[model samples]
Target: MATSSSTLPSLVVRMLRHGRLGPGLATLDLGTGAGGLAAYAARRLGDQHVTSIDVDPYLTEAASERLARMGLRPTFHAVDATAEIPGHYDRIVCTVAIRPGTGLRTVLGALHEGGRLVTTLAGTSLILTGWKHKTGELVGCIERGGAEFMLTRSGHDYPPALSELFAVASDEAGDETGTGRYPVMDVANAWEVRSMLEITTPGVQSRYSTHDRRRTLLLIHADGSWARAIGEWTDPPTVHQGGPRRLWDALERIRGRLNMEGALPLYGAHARVTPDGVVHLSRGQWSGSLGEE
Candidate 1:
């Protein structure tokens, strides 16, 4: 049976044990994969307490076999987890990344009050664990580091490749371009921005270079956008960009405010999930959103 790295299973186990599951607690393992979690939990919490689900029948079969070998028997189901999760779970642990909108809402709804949820958001594999404080309110923080996993298959995966969207647009010709400075703040890091844009607009890519010449350019598009800059407050930047929004401008604005305020915060950012699977973020004066098929 396929299994996550030893470290992840161990970390997950640690987190589960910390949460302290016992008799009468229903545990659901979404995207059970090889059922390592189910097997582990069954051994700790008892076989009848664990129920695992995955979209692939092969994975389910493998997990069943693996768990049986471990001398534990847990119910296994093969169903599209993104569509619906059967029964409520006191502790719902998703081994896969969840898309925004309905998929996210569905998983959130599957938890009982005060139920614990540990899952990954798009862009980063860092686990985010939270408890249902109340209906419509889930609070959690991201765990340090990252993990790599296949995306849930029910929705659009990566945005289209960058090569597919490379084209000369008549409207882009002779558009005003200029150089600018971007002073990054504490919370808004380059990796986070790039990851967010890549997931939101997959076609967008970036290259950062700093040699004798210091420069930063943010390129964006329908597929997505990328930003690269150099000099790091040492020299002026030479910026060139071509896309729907002035990519450099957005970066500079975010950076400038962060520098002045001493913090670049995404927390409390207003988020709206559209029915068709789009995530919109708005906070105070800033607003942006992305759509996916």
Candidate 2:
């Protein structure tokens, strides 16, 4: 089992301060893993006021022992976070990744008006602090940097196996595949694009690799469409593409536009999250969304 990183304590503390947690603010640490964040918050705000909870009794016991070593006694509860949260809290911080339809609306309802909730959506760690702008929108931005956390264990670690969706093709056949090129905007800095697509687009994964002897390879996907490119500059790139859509061509067009404009901006892109965790992206007149099997 991997432990939460040591830097998490200070990171959580900074997020707390960013969210404006003061001397009297009530704090709840959800998924308190080894009690690292709990202990750090307790020391910062005093143990009597911090409440820590986890679904696993063993994790609770380990957190208890860890807190004891720090000479801090924060209340620890063994309860399923997906079910019900004990009481309303001024600030709720979760150290686990939340999937779609995990009762996030219920958890958000538990926060007092003007109270803030900080947690990870999918796998990206974000700090959302809003004053309940109304009934529907809880608007916030991604915290300065990114943080990684483990998923809660309500079931087995690995999800049930997925049915085979594609047949493997020979390298020779794959090499002869049709290719297209598009000018791609700088997506590396676009966290929103990455997070939204990962959530909405099933089977979509990306890999970024730079070779010592060649240009970098940035791969993007969804279902059958696969796009691969070499080098960051120069058009008519070496591209190997296959599938339903000419994905490499789409990428080339985006890249060409980026080169024309001198830069591609990701913030101008629009994102929509479906109830089923699918993400749709639209920019200017071009748009695409994730599809299910």
Highest lDDT, which number?
Answer: 1
The TM-score, computed over Cα atoms with residue i paired to residue i, of candidate 1 is 0.65
lDDT of 2 by residue, 1-293 (tens): 45332436676666566556668778888877777778878888888878988777777888898889879998898876767778887787877765434445555656676677676555333333444334433444345455556655553243432223222211213433443354233344455544444433434444545545344334445355655655554343456555665444544455566568764433334444333333344557756543332
The local distance difference test score of each candidate is: 0.59, 0.57
Alpha-carbon RMSD to native, per candidate: 6.0, 5.5
Candidate 1 accuracy as lDDT: 0.59
- lDDT tens digits by residue: candidate 1, 195-262: 44444344344443344544333354563333333345455554545545655566565556656876
Q: Lowest-lDDT window of 10 residues in candidate 2?
A: 163-172
CA shift at 212, candidate 2, in angstroms? 5.4
- Candidate 1: residue 2 lDDT (0-100): 33
